[model samples]
Target: MISLTMEKRYEIGLDSYDRLFPNQDTMPKGGFGNLIALPLQKKARSNGNSEFVDGNFNSYEDQWFYLSNLKKVTIEKVEEILSIVEEREKEELNQ
Candidate 1:
């Protein structure tokens, strides 16, 4: 969910529906988009480098405590965000 939001915010990659927006031309040229490393691998998790953080960028002392409280991102919310992004892009193009 965070990844989707960040991709839209950065205007990169395809949306949740795998549709590419005009701001990003990631796939039309037959090139795959950039690959990203998964967070919190064994070593990074131990060193706290790839751990998830809060608004202040502080990783929680108990990673499991944070994971346990995570809520699933709803499909409706994803659609809503995509619609909002589409509208914003349209307005930008009109200007």
Candidate 2:
């Protein structure tokens, strides 16, 4: 058997959803439209910040990206994971 690979280009930024909840971060949390909006500040995480959720998602709009080829793989992975979480939430709600 043979398999083919596909690439997807997505624009990540601050996304607004119908629902809102606690972000549980040092800074205020808002709707997350897309992740990987910008490069992160070279800093560490504490009680009030995220180790991975650096920079602003709005800065990364209109750029094409793939899951496999990214400078910051952590950000992409986090985005993918969050999307999965959201998908599960919706599925659970529907069910």
User: Which of the numbered candidates is closest to the native, going by highest lDDT?
Assistant: 1
Worst 10-residue lDDT window, candidate 1:
31-40
Model 1 alpha-carbon drift over 4 Å, by segment: 1-37, 46-48
What are the models' TM-scores? 0.53, 0.25
Ten-residue region with minimum lDDT total, candidate 2: 1-10
Candidate 1 lDDT: 0.68
* Reference-based lDDT, each prediction: 0.68, 0.42
lDDT tens readout by residue for model 1, 1-95:
44567666876434434633443434447543332333645666787668889999988887778978999999999999999999999999999
Off by over 4 Å in 2: 1-73
1-95 per-residue lDDT for model 2 (tens digits): 01111113234323523433332222336544233432332231223233332167323322244323456659889999999999999999999
C-alpha lDDT of residue 29 in model 1:
70
RMSD in Å for model 2? 18.7
